[model samples]
Target chain A: MTENPNVPVLCATGVSAIVAGDAGDFRVLDGVSLEVDAGEIVDITGSSGCGKTTLLRALARLLPGAVGTLSLRGVSAHDLTPQAWRAAVALLPQKPTMVAGTVRENLLLPWTLKVRAQQSAPEDAVLRAALDGLHLSDVSLERDTDRLSVGQQARIALLRILMTNPSVLMLDEPDANLDDASAAQVTQATSQFASAGGAVIRVRHQRTDALASRRFSMCGGQLTETTS
Target chain B: MSGAGGVIVIGWWQLALATGLMVLTGALSVALKLGVAKQLAIATARTYAQLLLLGLVLGWIFGLDSPWAVLGVLVIMTGVAALTIARRAPDAPAGTTGISFLAMLLVGTFITFVVTGLIVRVEPWYLPRYVIPIAGMVLGNSMNGIALALERTFSDMDARSGEILALTALGATPWEAAAPSIRRAMRAAMIPGINTLSAAGIVFIPGMMAGQLLAGADPMAAAPYQIVVMVMVATADITGSTLAVMLTYRRRFGADDIYLERGYRPDSRS
Candidate 1:
């Protein structure tokens, strides 16, 4: 008898999603199933319009048109309150959104929400260290997010997600706008996170360096794992 | 000149000057992108002409010292102000414009009525000269504020929708997702009113005070009234605009994300 594939830290079974309209209902994922054990980095790569972003959104429970059984550690994504689902699974969108404020303000915004309000604020030194590890100076934290370069903004956005310490991180084209240095920072961070038992699911257009535990492709509205 | 009832002569040029002043202000507002100048000019002219005609009809009514006429005119002023606000904020939800207008009337009328009726204790009939002008000023300013607030609120929500969604995913409640945008829209709405209040005396003599002086009122007397009107206008504007923005936020977002209106293009109509 085959063991259940859904026994991992995060699982999406028989997932299907559509976008735009009911008439066409452009199917993005059909009967897609995936699993990520604790402390693994999974990469999803495919051509444009291959539904990579949609799959990530589905995992985050941010896609209204997505129909599936998505669960975190055996709890159904549908059963969890939106707040609960989001706090456990966070998605970093392709185009990082920066509110008009100081960099620190944007970084600390998630903590201000009632769901995460009880969490301790990230220490100033810890925040500064994250910025530095990402090759960003402490001065960058004081500057307005709008003033930062695109690469810096991307890293800062990722770092902000890290501050919340979500169990499952779903990233869509996170490295699309990043330069070599920022991209290196992202790889390092993901490696560190995975080693620490945090799971990461990311979508990329090209095969990225330093991440290949599990790879998948979306073709004809279905996800198929690519052989190593 | 008759012996018992004398002929009360008025200058046509004085009427022309007042009309010209109203037109000039209306035109200036349009040129400055404050509003639709031509429409405002027509509306102002129409209002002035109607007021003159109303004065003529009410001359006999006031002579009888009837309080009902005063009450009727006040109600008409409130209704017209409400309608104008409704028209200005059409992009808002179906009833939002009407709601904002009603809020404006409630705030403007409550303050003006309380101050004039209870505090100032103006005589019977309450003289349209005092009540009408004050009400018009308060209502007009509040309408602009509400319109601007509604525009800013919708536009800001549209622009910052991604951030709003991000917040929602980060466990922000719907209102929590919208709070930043709401605060920003309210602040933008208050800019004009705040600027006018801050620079009232130094920037330029406001129209009401200047008109009072031209109409033979003492400058000292007009100054106090102008100050009072400015204060009342600011209060009404802040109250109405803030309420309108806060109340309309839920309509802008969904349970899980920001709801983009179908075929909605940003600032396309504006």
Candidate 2:
């Protein structure tokens, strides 16, 4: 099929996944198709078992054993190297994983990876600004990430991903465990990211005011855009 | 000093030393949480008894002066070293069994043979005294190193698989993905030997030097040998640990990049 040239930043078609186990395979995603363009925030809401998270992972090419046609920035997801794909479209998993180190070290982790090693490290001012935009104080940078509260950890996780400067950001329940003020900060940061030409795909159990654009409902592994 | 014929029988003191050694080994075992106190006590007692009996048997073998007996003892020592290494590392993969056995054999044989044969120029018939003790020292150091390496590598891999995958996704090669964890584990594996080396004279007199002195060697004469053994042990520890960690990566991760079996559960008791 001819590709859309508003050429969505991330796209997937006929993507299906099965959770492998000893008993049998349980289908998680089936023929799921969606697209997110630059400067767009796509909110995907579904019940617990509807594979919204799996679909997001499929788009990011992070889901193992997933079968589908997925692409980012007009490049086939399957053809691009994982590093290139991740640099283009990164996923922030449901439970944020913090490497054992200080906040600055965690923030600078993506730079240490060979894929992004050629890129110059972010300046101290830029990193501090990103942290500040997430409502995190400059002092948070010196604290151990493991010692941060859940809300603080979530904000730091987002800041870490943002430091990579990926074109597309897929977050699974970015606001799931956050307090009201932290959730608002996430929404504000994400909205700013979308307005600045980054694609945002968020999976949540309930819709939030954070998503100001299109909203989609995932049911029985099917997605349909709705105004509700 | 007052014994008949002025022989001054100190054999009882040796017996007491042996008893005290058993008690110390048992206490250390308990303190390390290696096993139940009673089980460790029994194991220590059995170990001392076995060593004493082996010494008597070796005395006879030495008196007989047969090449076959010497070969037999070497084979037994190799077998014991291999088995002990394997047992201490139960979580290691089957491939590691061969790796560890070969490593113990190669390192222990190379160091002991080269030191005694080429450097010391001990008589061929005197191989037992030099080769057995040196081999035992090398094998023992390698065993601890391998155990630490295997445990550290696997645990670090397990705990940091996500970080590794993140790195891989970020375009790091396999070696690059594993480099940091491997380095950390290698350092950790080498720490015990490093610490012993650092604290050698100030903290404790190593057993080998103390034993040599007890056997009537001048302290000054025994110093060089102790230093040699320490250097050899450090070499064995570093070489064995790095090799073990390198070999473990092949078994720990699958082709699809998922952790395979529980190859090296760092939490598992040895």
Candidate 3:
């Protein structure tokens, strides 16, 4: 699945968002714009409540009333169906959502979507291999997701996203719930994804800067590139 | 026709006795600080006024024998019922009131008109006596179901919206993500209709059947009428609730299967 490494896979321009709170209307993302090329890992760092998650969701088109021009793989977001565009630019939320089923069923759910109708699930061997690389080899696909720990759920959620084979990965603190080994595995996976001509945008909480090729800081809804 | 034209009559003295009982209950509520005496009084007064007005209005409609008049009344009734049902919805995701209006009007008219005009074969098709009351019976029950469905669906969204949005993230369509909540809400809404069927004749002669019998209808006629109505009402409830859940849940999600943001969530909850 490797392609030209420097292709501009996703580009955003003039994206702005406002959200209401108990206090009043708050501008969470204001005219934020960026571009992520193939093999690019863009790390977003910010203090809590600095709107990093908001910006990521805006880019993903999950935030309503977020006005922006975004193109993925040369196709404008407006021209693509939300389901179709999301299949290419997936945003992994901060908290993992588990359906009432075994891990296997949840992981295979995306294939059942009409947008992904042309695709089929990865075989069990491939899935197990990917899980093993994420330090989740011991986890059984037959295991109930409800019985999994928070950490396990987080990792499994990432695994499901990867199974979709998205071109752009928007991870909101992807390693927040992981221990050192699992976090390392997560970083390794992101690097591997980028190297395979995919793009990664991680909202990082840690001081580590090795994985991301470029870094941006979010403060008061503005995304500014950091000299890294 | 007189208000108490049936075989059994609630004479004014008997009405006085019932009023006394209600007053006693209200007094007990106030004394015990149950905090509902004022509501009890207001409800009682409103009931009296509303029923008195209804009695006069139905008497006039029945006397008129005008089909267009009856149809107009049904339309207005349906509109009010829909809005009432929607008003009970949760204040989230917007446009729920409009959804209820659409569901209630379509379901209410389809079921009510079909039964009264076709199955019952009420001569003139819009006989005010038959059409108005039957429409009320059908719409009233269906309205409850629609309201319950909207409430359940919307509240479930509040609790499980994150899960729903997560499904959207995985490239599922809005309908696919919301199908679970819609199904659950429809089931919850149908409970009352189901209960009515199970309890109908055995528990007590249903209101319509009993009322008709008291008004001098033969058992032969009353029995079939009750059966037809029971089936019609259950159908109406199921149709109303299902349509409401499906229509309203679809509106909650975005046009392109994105989860429409209601407000801010610190942790990426929809």
Best by TM-score: 3
| Count of backbone collisions within predicted model 2 | 0
Q: Write the per-residue lDDT of candidate 1 for residues A102-204, one digit (tens) a residue.
A: 9888888888888887788887788888888877874566798878888887888888887788888888888887777778788888788788878899898
Q: Could you tell me which 10 consecutive residues in candidate 2 chain B have the lowest summed lDDT?
A: B261-270
Instruction: Estimate, for each residue in A58-129, the C-alpha lDDT of model 3 and write its tens digit.
Output: 777787778989988677888887887888999899898888899888888888789888777789888888
Where model 2 places Cα greater than 4 Å from the true spot, the runs are A1-8, A11-25, A29-36, A49-51, A54-70, A74-79, A100-102, A137-147, A210-228, B1-45, B52-95, B102-106, B121-128, B156-184, B201-203, B256-270
lDDT of 2 at B241: 73
Q: RMSD of each candidate? A: 6.0, 6.0, 3.4
Q: What are the models' TM-scores?
A: 0.77, 0.75, 0.90
Q: How well does candidate 1 score on lDDT at residue B21? A: 81
State the TM-score of the second chain for every model: 0.73, 0.78, 0.88
Error of 3 at B240 (Å): 1.6
DockQ, all models: 0.40, 0.23, 0.55
lDDT of each: 0.75, 0.75, 0.81
lDDT of 1 by residue, B26-61 (tens): 778877888678787778878878978977866764
Q: Per-residue lDDT for B166 in model 1?
A: 72
